[model samples]
Target chain A: MLARVFEASGLSSVQISLLREHTEKIRPPRALFCPFPFGLALGKPNDPEFQHRVLDHAFSLLERPSGPVLEDFPEEIVPADAPVTPAEERPPDPAFELTALRGYYDRFVAHHGRTAVGLTGVPSTRFRGLVRLLERYAAGEEIEAPTPDLSAAQYARFACDDIKAFFREARMEQYPAENGPQIDAWFWQQTAMGPMMRRVRDRMLASGDRQVEMLSYGIYREPDTPNPEWKYLTPTAVKTDGG
Target chain B: MPHLKHLPDMKRNEMLTFPAQVNHDTPWTPPARPLREARLALVTSAGLHRRGDPPFVSNHHEPDYSYRRLPADTPAAEILQSHASAGFDRSGIQRDLNTTYPVDRLRELLMRGAIGSLADSFYSFMGALRNVARLEQETAPAVAELLRQDGVEVVLLTPT
Candidate 1:
């Protein structure tokens, strides 16, 4: 939506979209469809080459000098066979232990209490349940189905997001007006939960369980690119002199 | 193009019934100069904000129609994704920040002379807006003004 506004204001705009159908429907000035999973629009993590390629394709649209152009990225996010460091090869961050997560949560509750953390619709009591699920998943054990109130997927979301909230709030309190990067670095690299989540991802990949895969990476299917049959607005083609 | 075959026929029908936003009257504005001589800015609906900035309100009952400004040189590590949309998978972004906000890649482009310069700041807003009218009338135009103030000639947007 903002894309169109930028263009309407006389700035050339291009969008990299995961939902090509929606992009085509909205008809941004220029759109590039990437078949990657939702959050990873550019490419795999730590892969600069792939990210640059996606950006390159997106930037090329700027030269088109037209309206409502939607193009497909001609690549798939093939799983990279990059070597995974063995668990022992990587030293653990003492700060990210389960106890530390609990500590942060406790500190967060003590500081801001339930009123601040309850927004996620996850009661504070469920923190332990979330941790247990993470432990089980990281250990490669079968995860028990969540109770009717909280499905397995919801449990995962609660765990990850709640932990993030705890860390964010705690950082704000500690730094008292510091930049966010310090807190972010601590959460992802220094926290025990970070490695734990990575382990969970590794385990899920190794298990090859379809449901688990979906929960971790999301449903991977082809994007619904615009076709001639769909009723879409195609602006009259106007040739402009190269400026 | 893949058809919406996976969706139930009724759901597909409902989706088709939903109105799509198309404005045929908006004239195309071509860049007046080459990219290497134009200032580029990034505007994303990926719900990205600088770490210390107040996070976008994701609660469905009360959505925030606000945007965040990320400085041109802000490290990808410092940018956080707080989007509440249930549609996209976030694992790739969680693992690598570049997937959503490619600040580093844009910098590389500037160094390589692929683009003339980067805007002083980029903009981000959550795309899961229930208040489309508010966005169109207020937030977008406000951001566009900021972009104009920064001399942004081209924008690259990554919509979540």
Candidate 2:
């Protein structure tokens, strides 16, 4: 859509797409459909060579003298591709995990000069309130929304994202060798937050708000369930290939 | 594999009928110039904005049709994402901005002469806009005009 507009307006455009189905529908002038999951348009975090390779393919499409070119990049990077070395020991609690990872997170900020923990619009120092909301929700209590405009489930979803990001970035700093999906798999499939978030989703559904039903989907997913797949979960398109 | 195929029996039919717009004529433009001489710009649907910028509404009932301008010089830390979709993975982006925006990698390309200069500013819109009639009609063209004003000859768009 936006890509089409840019091309229609005379700007040479190319996009990296996660869901080929939707791309096929919109038929943007040029698209490179990646097998990577949603939210990961490029191959990996901290992998510059791969990123450049993706870019190289994207840039090359510009010279084809073509219409609505949609092609697949040859490589596929999945979380299952990473080697899993167990951490020394799992932390007993999210708070404990947060405490343990702060030093590394601070170092990441000092060295990289940025952090991705601000989606909540709440300060890093005030993030614990959001965290506590999740904790109390998981403990089977009705919870209030962190921000005024959203429902508890909505804020819980974003809060968990922020908390997961905070912890993931710190863990990445400690173990620079770990890939993003590997860390994410560790957090969601193997950590306390995963089960806790699942509990939050259960409660949200139990509470019975039509809005929370959809928002709860992103809060958590189990190891091998048929949960929402972000790839074709585009705003309007629903995929039909059973991956 | 197409994602909708993997949905549970109950949700598959409803999801399958969601009505994504299909354009028989996808707009097209070939290379206007050599990559090394073109002024490139990044346009994304990642809901990215500078930290202090007004956050996009994460409301489920509505999509934010507005766009944000992120200067090429904005610090990596200052760029924040407020995409409202519940389905995408955030870990890759949370760890490396390149996975989504690739600002640093684009900079490297500029330095290495893989291509020419970058636009002074890049653009972003929130992801998963359920209704984009306004976007296709207004905001997007407005953005195109901005790119034209910047002399951006090439654009690389990454969607969340």
Candidate 3:
């Protein structure tokens, strides 16, 4: 493990281990095993109090005057979002969703003083139109990139990543209690963009474009995650909002 | 990590071969002092980098043993995570990078003198490495020396 390598170099280190099995196997000098979900090394996001508690635990392992110490983190983190459930409302169009989320996202930016959007160099204000153009390509229609510097495929990759980032950031603003997986399930299982992007990915693969397939797979879905199976959230999962 | 256990068959099959990497001797290094006085740095396996830095290689056959240095003061917007590991949930870090990196919490510690100070920058590596040998043989010492030179007395490691 990396902690062992660092320790070998005469640096004392303590790590927050997400996997107890791996920690037990590798046996780093000092590690605090957290039972939190994958990718949440510090438990819940947006909660500094919990994050500080996790950090304090990991750092305190440094005080043990011994070798190869591993401890379990004490607290059990209850997920912030409600149980993953079928959405009672139809998956909204990206245009309407983007427009509706803009104000809350702006508030998020104002409150946090930063955003994870802007990876594609396109301004946030124009995301709805840009998403419209990008989605057209996902549907197998050919379209040119907005700028000459990037190709349509390349721009699509960037656009895809940026739009998803925007959605997550904005969604967090509206649903601060939702955990990470809950938010991701909402995007991939309950959003129109999810299936549209899947079409873009499938088309790329169907065209024998290995490079693009690899690129889009990295951007849109984690190939190993339970996502992207394209099975859930069918018409039965939809309900009429208001006639 | 539930996701690791519940990986798609492709990944689950691959992860079962990690026992070979775990056979190394357990190395130990006692802390020189308490954490409150020790200068600290973060080392994350979250595949994060600044905007302009090249990403980790995007496939499983060949892993990129390279690392990226992210300035501690970099804004959340300037940071980017390019990990493409299967079944890994990125949405948490996407919402608040502190879930994995916790630089904000570290900054708070530096302000309160919960620790002496933070290194000017942090180190990052992509997770889901099939080749830990190269990382141990090469990149680890390279980064260790970098930390040594930077006067970092302790490290808090986080992974995605």
**Which candidate wins on lDDT?**
2
What's the best-to-worst order under TM-score? 2, 3, 1
Better of 1 and 3 by DockQ: 3
Clashes of 1: 4
Identify the leading candidate in terms of DockQ: 2
- Candidate 1 lDDT over B1-160, as tens digits, reads 1234544465355345434454444436688788899999988888877765655653223456788888877765467666633244444454446667777788888999999999999989886453466677788899999999999998888765
> How well does candidate 2 reproduce the true complex, by DockQ?
0.49
**What CAPRI class is candidate 2?**
acceptable
Models 1 onward score TM values of: 0.60, 0.83, 0.78
Structure candidate 2, residue pairs in collision: A114-B77, A239-B4
Instruction: Assess candidate 2 and give its lDDT.
Output: 0.75
Each model's backbone clash number: 4, 2, 3
Best of the two (1, 3) by TM-score: 3
Question: How accurate is chain B of model 3, given as a TM-score from 0 to 1?
Answer: 0.87
lDDT of 3 by residue, B1-160 (tens): 5335554575554344333245446787887877778888899988888876765554333466789998889888788876633245666777688989898899898889899889987899888664566777889789999998999989888998
A1-243 per-residue lDDT for model 2 (tens digits):
888889888889989987777788888888898877677888777789999999999888888876778888998754344345455455567666667677888887787778878767777666657767888977877777655777666677778777777777787788877765567667765666656667777876555554565566555544443433343356544433210
- Per-residue CA lDDT of model 1 for A110-227, tens digit only, reads 6533222332344555655666677776776766544564445435544556555555565555553433334544544556666676566456444444434433432111224221
Which residues of candidate 2, in runs, are more than 4 Å off?
Answer: A81-93, A138-152, A223-243, B1-19, B58-60, B84-86
